[model samples]
Target chain A: MADQSQPPLTRIQQKNRDLILEGALSVFSVNGFRGATIDQIADAAGLSKPNVLYYFASKDDIHKTLLTTLLDMWLAPMIRIDPDGDPLEEVMTYVRAKLEMSRRFPRESRLFAYEILQGAPHLTEILGGGLRQIVDRAATILQGWMDDGRLAPVEPRHLIFSIWALTQHYADFEVQVRAVLGPGHDPFVEAGPFLDNLYRKILGL
Target chain B: MADQSQPPLTRIQQKNRDLILEGALSVFSVNGFRGATIDQIADAAGLSKPNVLYYFASKDDIHKTLLTTLLDMWLAPMIRIDPDGDPLEEVMTYVRAKLEMSRRFPRESRLFAYEILQGAPHLTEILGGGLRQIVDRAATILQGWMDDGRLAPVEPRHLIFSIWALTQHYADFEVQVRAVLGPGHDPFVEAGPFLDNLYRKILGL
Candidate 1:
């Protein structure tokens, strides 16, 4: 989404952009795309509306830019699964990595969830094309493990879906998860062994 | 949330209320609470804004009424897991029931997801009180099963969280799930055996 034709941003420019994006994420994640406004983003970013607009053309531009960056970050965990490595360890690593991300980056997780909950109007192209391609590649690798009997034979895509569902819920549904788990308990820690057991069983480890 | 002191609604009153709620669900589920408007609900319900106002005191009223009803319906599935029933069967029944609800009531699923995504501002009392109580009871039942070795030993609360995460993702992230699966495949059908395997393993059947 970066314009190659433009000159590289100076550090000050880059910092301002990051500030705006961070603020925009706060607004967009909680208020959602339709609900968020430039004024709100500007206020959150500690900039004037004109300054925020000076950085991005419009609210849609900010959202699309945020999602573009997010999809890449989202994919990095999946891409960490090394096909050449031992299958169960690799899968658990991926699962743990996802859980860690949920713990660390809940706001980003909610931003993505909010997008899909509203039908991914800003993200359809990436979800259907780039996202699906990475998932298909991962499926192929998972199926290869199954074919060799290194993992349990299950539909690879649904397995992928399950991994995503199990991990992201910690972030996207943090409020409910925390409320239900009650006080003084860490959800990610509690989730660790259970996810390990299920994945290990599913992988035939 | 129903007013016990109020007289029962006539058939016409009930029908109109249903229409407004249905229309509100369509709007609120898609646009979320901060984004939705009474005018939009009025248009979706085929009533004037004044008429929509006459039935519900405000947009907040419509959303609260809808979510209050949704919580009861949501609890019904968990309540169906009879404690005296075979623990594994009861758990699977609850799992399938949740998945089926995701398939049959995606809008409702997303509405609930959106509410939680935005911090459960309207549903906090229920989440902290009523909802937690039912989940605690189920957790107690699950723990009893584990103590008897009728199910696998794991944190019952985390196991319940896994069930919700895996099933609701189908509805909450339907757009992404459909895009990844591509054309023609029924997600619920594909998800059935996969979830069955998971429950079977987690329950140590």
Candidate 2:
């Protein structure tokens, strides 16, 4: 029988898991969860189907693992919004962190977007639990800022939504952004200042 | 052979076409273009495969038709931003119209979101040609407003992108919004005023 409390994954197991996840990310990001197939992921990872299954029980397991990890990374910026930090600086830092994530991890953004677009079937529990917890905490901090007159008074939740919407648009809607901006334009370069100006103006910072 | 450009579609033909498009919208919105099948669309439309094919040659054809019609409706709000109207009013009008579309036609919005998320393989031409043309024209008008000091100066293209992001986020990310807001909270009710406040503050209107 397998040991109930084994040590963490060995080096090879960790490497294989990483390989599977990286391959799954590419497939799932492009094809979405429903559209992607296990064979495709297995082929992408250069592993046999049984080998991949040894790491993940099924396609849903693989997808769930990816999504769980993604949620952690996706919300890290919001979680980092220090309650004790200066209001405007903290908000601005959060915005910058989100936009940088959009620029650096566009596939992850699109993967999440695709899930949300499909009504977040796999993410409902986490969205309601962990996501709501973090958002509520962040919203409380933002409200405190508003109450203390350190930031302009507005709906704190909506403000966070706006930040997410504006920044992630560059990543999730990259094709549309690039189409309108044309060939030579670097969207992130312009987006950084554009968003900074927008938040400043809106927050009266 | 069928006459090439005889009159417009017959009443029955138009009705069937609309039925097909409606079904396609629901399917594509949920499953995405690649994930959706003609049989599913036909079943959703309460028609046989042959009947569906009578109106649209293939799944691609049906998706293309839906996308083409959607682009028109999607951009109509932008096109209605009259150059002669009050700058802020025109911009606000566009924002409201877009938000209303999100509230009324979320499926359409998701269909477009799915296509865009997939790198817009099917929409490159329309995005580059029609979308770019209208955006360029709108950007010109927005730039004029800035030049005349009627509005705050920023990148007009980015301004449009922001409007798209903020407004469509409600529809495209409805699951997340609903999850965070919890039950019995009408997102659109708060969204209307929240967005109005945001744009007013940002534009210094």
Candidate 3:
């Protein structure tokens, strides 16, 4: 959020901030908010403690930066649901985008999962305000599609939840998924068609 | 696990142990394994830290106990998917049972989520050995049913994951689910029919 108001930094400063955020993401994803510490983040980031602190005010600050940045990325796909598009294909696009995120951005997905699992103390405001509005708008659009028989009727609001659940599961529970599938199988690659078929079944291909 | 080998606890001892475990569950559910402490568990359990330690050796001990106990309850549902039962109904039974856990035992659900999210360090053995065997058995049964066309064919292993992801989302992401739906909606209640329709579509009711 303050990304807009903060004065632009030199390339070095920007690079250091990215390293700190990347390191912080690794530590925080494993340890949650309570267990993570500045020293750990600094070590993971390959910087001295002072150097890390110079870029961010506190651990909370780094966590928030990661989360807010994440919230934007998280909401982008939903916001891309165009009302004028073919409803089923539009949804399939969202599904593909989310699965691609799970494949490409698993650490980010786990970090988001940890924050939410911990009650989203830093996130409750945006959750109800920004996130809810976007979800509601998407839900309404889905509802319209359903009413017109352009989409199969289920709870439009909850259908989004199913999408989140199915796609994010690949990332959030990757270990369990790998364990279940055993060797020589890529969970995400297999999941692509399974999910494509699933949404098609629910929404009518 | 030691419940089998240890001398049967006296009624008082059993009651005290239950209290400590219940308290530990509350703390550990909110605080992941690394973030939880003996004093906190004792405080939540209404016992002295020493007393809590007496019942459980350390924080790790308590966490392991909770996890091992949870593993049993978690497997009970999947284990109950009878090979001889009606195919779709059996899957529905598993779905309903998982959802019921989300509703009645959300903390447990989040605790399990937190554990898995962190790579299941303490649980990897069971995950790969005991858990894999059961899931394999269940998957094989479903695959057999699919082979017979008694159930609609989807990826049998992955379908189990979808069940877990959808049902557990209500518990693990309760805050997000609530915020998205706004006021006056019970996520679990609404989820029941939506999920029923979903699985029925996938499995062919």
Give the number of the best model, judged by lDDT. 3
Q: What is the lDDT of residue B79 in candidate 1?
A: 78
The clash count for each model shown is 0, 0, 0
Model 3: what TM-score for its first chain? 0.95
All candidates' TM-scores?
Answer: 0.97, 0.95, 0.97
Task: Give the whole-model CA lDDT for all candidates, comma-separated.
Answer: 0.91, 0.90, 0.92
**Separate DockQ for every predicted complex:** 0.84, 0.82, 0.85
Tell me which residue pairs clash in candidate 2. none
User: B59, model 3: CA deviation in Å?
Assistant: 0.2
Candidate 1 per-residue lDDT, tens place, A1-205, comes to 7767988899988999999999999998887888788999999999999999999998899999999888889789898788999988888999999989988888899899999988999889988899999999999999999899898888999999999999999999999999998999899888888899888877774
Residue-level lDDT of model 3, residues A19-88, one tens digit each, is: 9999999998787888788999999999999999999998889999999988899879999999999999
Q: Poorest 10 consecutive residues of model 3 chain B by lDDT? A: B1-10
Cα lDDT tens digits for candidate 1, B117-197: 889999899899999999999999999998998887888999899999999999999999999999998999999989998
lDDT by residue for model 3 (B28-147), tens = 888787778888888988999998888877888888888998889977999999999999999999999999989999989988999999999889988889999999999999999999
| Better candidate by TM-score, 1 or 2 | 1
